[model samples]
Structures are given as structure tokens and as C-alpha cells.
Target: MASGALAKPQMRGLLAKRLRFHIVGAFIVAVGVACAYKFGVAEQRKKAYADFYRNYDSMKDFEEMRRAGIFQSTK
Candidate 1:
């Protein structure tokens, strides 16, 4: 009868310890995901933009725009 009365509280303490471990694991996973995104997706986007504009001609684009009458006056 005495052990039966103590069982619920003991079970709750064990569950609380397990819950702490789960919380820590979740935090570690979140940090890992954030790091992967920063070094993977974000870095790839920056490199792609750099590669795209590497051989671009701004003057040619401006001239084309002017010929198309997009600009009302020349600066």
C-alpha cells in the first residue's frame, strides 16, 4: 500500500527528467537547422547572384532602356 501511494510521484519525477533531455535535444536540432540554412541556402543565393551579374553591362542596359523610351530625359 505504501509503495502504491509513492508510485505516481516517482513516475512524475522520471518523466520530468526525460522531458528535460527532450527539450535539450530539440534545442540542439533547431540550432543545427539554422546553421545549415545559413551556410547552405543563404550562401548559395549570394553566390548565384554574384555569378549572374559577373559579366553584366549596366551601360548597355541603360542604352537599351533609353532607346525604348523608358527614360524621358538623359542624365
Candidate 2:
């Protein structure tokens, strides 16, 4: 005639397992997101620098100084 409450085990073990799984999953997801963000930013910066240098025209005015001997060979 006893109640069934004492027949069942506590749910602490299952709860602990579930919590552990959630914690691990969250940690992995955070790491993955951080890496993606970091790589994306790096790629953007790389592309920006490349584009800037590609169109920079550092020697755009070199023709005017070509005959000045300013950059002529010293030999």
C-alpha cells in the first residue's frame, strides 16, 4: 500500500547530463561563431588593402620626372 514515490530514483543524474550537454554545445557554437567573425573581418581588410594598393598609382607622376635624372641609374 506504500506510495510509488519512493520507488523511482531522483532525476538529478538526467538533469546533470542534459546541462552538461547544453554547456558543451554552447561553448562549441561560441567558438565557431568567433572564428567565423574573425576570419570574415580579416578577409574584408585584406580585400580592402588589395584594392587600395591596386588602384593607388604610386608612380602616376613618374613620367614627368623620367628625364630629370632624379631617378636615373647612378651607374
The per-model lDDT (C-alpha) reads 0.90, 0.80
Highest lDDT: give the candidate number.
1
Q: Give per-residue lDDT, candidate 2, residue 60.
A: 64
Which regions in candidate 2 have their CA more than 4 angstroms from the true location? 1-10, 46-75
What is candidate 2's lDDT per residue for 1-75, written digit by digit as tens?
876665676676898998999999999999999899878898889989998888666566565566566676632
Model 2 TM = 0.46
Estimate TM-scores for all models: 0.63, 0.46
Task: Note the residue pairs that clash in candidate 2.
Answer: none
- Deviation in Å, model 1, residue 22 alpha carbon: 3.6
Please report the TM-score between candidate 1 and the true structure.
Answer: 0.63
Stretches of candidate 1 off by over 4 Å are 1-6, 11-19
Clashing pairs in 1: none
Candidate 1 lDDT over residue span 1-75, tens digit each: 455554445664798899999999999999999999999999999999999899889999999999988998873
